[model samples]
Each structure stands twice: as C-alpha cells, then as structure tokens.
Target: MSQYSILAAAVEHRLLEKNSEFITFLQPVSDREQALHWLQHYREHYKDAAHVCWAYIIGNTRQPQTQAFSDDGEPSGTAGKPMLHVLTERELGNCLAVVVRYFGGIKLGAGGLVRAYSAAVSQAAQQARLTLVSPQSLLRIAADFALEARIRQLLAQFDATLLDVQYQQGVALSVSLAAADLASFKLQLQELCAGAVSLTEPTA
Candidate 1:
C-alpha cells in the first residue's frame, strides 16, 4: 500500500485490574533495531516487574519481514499474542507495544491475562495520535543550470521535498517524493527538459 497509519508519538497507559498493575508503552518504530531498543529499554527500566511482554510489527504491513512477540513469564498465547492482535486489528504498522505487569498477589487466569494485556494495549492505542504516512523514495536528478528553476517549480508542483542540491558541471538535485508519484514525475521531467535531464532510479 502507498499509505499506512503510524503512531504520531510515543504514548503510555496504565491499568489496574484485580490488584495487578499493567503498564502499556506504545511507540512508532521504523525498523527492527528501533523496536528492539525500546523493548530493551523498558525491560531494564522495569526489571522488577512480574512480566514484561512485548510485540512489534516492523517493515511494510502487507508483507512484514520482522514481526515477533514474547509472552515473558506469562502463559504462552496469553500476553504477547493478544497484544499483537490488538495492534494488527488496528492495522498499525511500524510500531511496538510493550506491557509491563506487576503481580498483585492474586493470579489472573489465562483468559483474564489475555484480556488484561489486550485491554492495556487497546487503551494505549486509543489515546495515541496516529498519522498517515505515504511511502517515499529518494530521486536524484541531474540537469543543466538553465533548467534549475523549472526543476524546482516542477518539484513543488509534485509535492516533492528537496533534500540536497549540488552545483557541479550541472545541477544535481536530490529529492524525496511519494513512491506512487515516481513514474509521473519522471515523465514530467523528461517532457520539461526535452529529455536533457537525467533521472536516476529511486532509492528507498
């Protein structure tokens, strides 16, 4: 897909159920490394907690290459899986959710554990602000000085963001644009410069 929903910023929610303390942390993560870093950070920070369950979905939602969850000490399929289900049901991408639990003497059965974990994540997600992000790619274009103004104008028209510009033999401009717009942008560039401008394959 060209666009997906992602957390606007990090958020947290705390819930108390049957004397058990549950804290949920939600944050946007672009890759596996970022997700792991946050998970480790929380684990260390809450080392005394009874359980630290976590689930993350990284990479494209359509075909996620990195997706994992850990139930920690909680019964399998009770903590991590339910938390992941909450994230997946919301169609969230590139995000991580961690639920830290502090035992409250009394024990919640397996069903209760699932509900608690899922509820924690659901509450945090509800409070979180989400932003729609379109897939973007880097495009490098080389043109003569005469075409610089025209190139800039075209980029603005296409809603492309200029990343860098170099004045060498000619002008080398690096720009970022939605992946969906790449083909049309290339066509417009060719027509505008009468095929004089050189375009490079886009990089993610």
Candidate 2:
C-alpha cells in the first residue's frame, strides 16, 4: 500500500462569469481547532466575498474520524455539501477545502451553488500537487572511528534519509530506507561492515 502527503498551503484561481477568486487547501490537520483556525484566517482574508463555506476530513484509517461542513449562511445543501463531495471523491484524508465565493450579483440557486463550490475546489486541487509517501524502516547505527568511512560510502549509493546523527564515545547515525528496499540496504551494510555493524529498527 502507498500513502500520499497533503499539499502545502497555496492559492489557485477559479473564475466564473465576471467574478474570480482563489481557493486554497492544505492538510495533515486532524482537529477542529486547526480547521477553525484556517476557516477564521480564510474568512478574514476573503472578507469581501459573499460566502466562505468549507468542509474538512480528519483522522486516518486507524483513528476516530470527523467530517464537517458549513454553508456560511447559504441555502442548506448548496455550498458545503458539494465541497465535501469533492474531498470524498478524491479520497483525501486529514484535509480541508475552503471556497471563497465572490457573488457575481447573480443568484445561483441550489444547483448552481453546488457546481460552483465543487469546481472551485477541483481547480485548487489540480494546482496543489501531491507526493507519494510510504512507510520506511529507520535504522540506528553506533560505530567506532574505523567504521565511519566505509558506512558513509555504502549509504551514499542509496537514497537514504538521514534522520539524525549524534556523537559521543562513538558516532551514532540514524537513517531511514524505504521498507521495500530494506533487504538490499541490509545486504550492503553488512558487506561494508564485514558483519561487524549492528543495525536495529527504530520506532515508527
């Protein structure tokens, strides 16, 4: 299975009629306070707009889930539901979407409201790129002076994420490798250490 990181907070544009506004969404937020914080900030920035309805999905596969929607005073089922629909369709987790509606002075009834809100979020999502994230095994290695160079050279060949390094009586290196590539990593490490290096998995 694969995991994906949420997009960074950024702006993307969507226009309808003579009115145009930007919608922004970002994530990893899993609590009501964080969602409200973003909502409050969004409302402040887009205060001139006619509406600022939003929806959010919180929690992941192993935790308590929460979903919320608000119409910001628009007719019931018009604004917030569509925003929620877009988030669900994308299978997004722990994310929020805010639609800054600039009323074109045109009353878009229920159908139009839904379409506009959905389209705004869709446009923003297209602009905010997502990256693949996966579980990796973190290894902690403590070695004496003689083992440093050989270990560094071996690790250089793979895309190792250096999580941390500490120096004490000896040097301790903390690195992470993709779980799928762990066996190869172990093989290379052992060859470099000549079976002397101690490798241990860190807590997730």
Candidate 3:
C-alpha cells in the first residue's frame, strides 16, 4: 500500500474494571528500540503497579516489519494478544501501547482480563487522533544541462521533492517521491528525455 494510518502523537487513557486501574498509553514508535525505550520508561515510572504489559507494531500494521507483545505475568493471550488485536484491527502502524494495571485486591479471570486489556487500548485508540503515512522513495538522476528545467518541471508533475542538485557531471539531481510513483516517474522521465537520462537509487 502507498499509505497507512499511524498515531498522530502520544495519548493516554485510564480505565477502571472491578476496582482495578488500567492506564493505557498509546504512542508513536518508529522502531523496536523506540518501543522498548517507551516500555522501559513505563515500567520504571509505574514500578508499584501490579502488571505493565505492552504491544508494538512497526512499519505497516497489516504486514508489519516487526511486532511483539508481552503478557507481563498475565495469563497467556489475555493481556498482550488482545491488546495487539486492537491495534491491528484499527490499522495503526508504528505505534506502541502499554497498559499499567494496579491490582485492587480483586482477581479477574482470564476472560475478564482479556476484555479489560482490549477495552483499555480500544478506548485509547478511539479517542486518539490518527495521521496518514505515505511511504517515500529516494532517487538520483543524471541528465544533460539542457534538460535541467524539464527535469525540475517533471518533479512537480509527480509531486516529487528535490533534495539536491549538482552542477558537475551535467546536472545530477537527488529527489524523493512517493514510492507508488517511482515506476511511472522513471518511465515518464525517460520518455521526456528521449531515453538520454540515467537514474539510480542510493544505497540504503
């Protein structure tokens, strides 16, 4: 997909079930490291809490590059799995959700725990704002100086951003555009330049 939904910013929601307090935090996380950093922060801040569980989905939530969840001593599939399901169902990517649960001298069975955790995250997600994320691709092009204006004009046609331009070697341009437009951009560039232009991608 060219674009997807992601968290606009960090958000927190509080839930109460049978005297138990569930503080849910939903935050934008770009990678596993950021997710872990946020999780650790919660763990330290809520050191007195009974359980601190978390789930994170990196990249596209549908086909995430990386994802993981933790029960944090809760029964298997009760806390973490359901929490993750909420994020996936909401189609949110590059996000982390942490629920800090404070026991209230009441024991919730597996079903109750699952419902509480899922609901906690669901409530936060529903209340949180979401922003669109468009995947971008970087490109480098080499063309004659005569095609400078044409190349620059083509960029706007494709909604491309010009990153850099080198005068040497007959105008080398560094540009970025939506990943979905890469193929069409290349084709149109070659056609417009009569196949005299060369394109290359930077090594990631």
The candidate that wins on TM-score is 3
Query: What TM-score goes with each of the models?
Result: 0.91, 0.66, 0.95
Question: Of the pair 2 and 3, which is ahead by TM-score?
Answer: 3
How many angstroms is residue 135 displaced in model 2 relative to the true structure, after the best TM-score fit? Answer: 4.9
Best by lDDT: 3
TM-score result, candidate 2:
0.66
The whole-model lDDT of each prediction reads: 0.90, 0.73, 0.94
Give the clashing residue pairs of candidate 1, or none: none
Candidate 2 Cα RMSD (Å): 4.6
Worst 10 residues of 3 by lDDT: 1-10
- In candidate 2, what are the lDDT values of residues 18-54, reduced to their tens digit? 3545354544465878888988988898888878888
lDDT of 1 by residue, 16-116 (tens): 99999999999899888999999999999999999999999975655675888999989989999998888887766788999999999988999999999
Instruction: Tell me the spans in candidate 1 whose CA falls farther than 4 Å from its real position.
Output: 202-204
Looking at candidate 1, what is the lDDT of residue 193?
Answer: 98
Better by lDDT, candidate 3 or 1: 3
lDDT of model number 2: 0.73
Between 1 and 2, whose TM-score is larger? 1
* Superior by lDDT: candidate 1 or candidate 2: 1
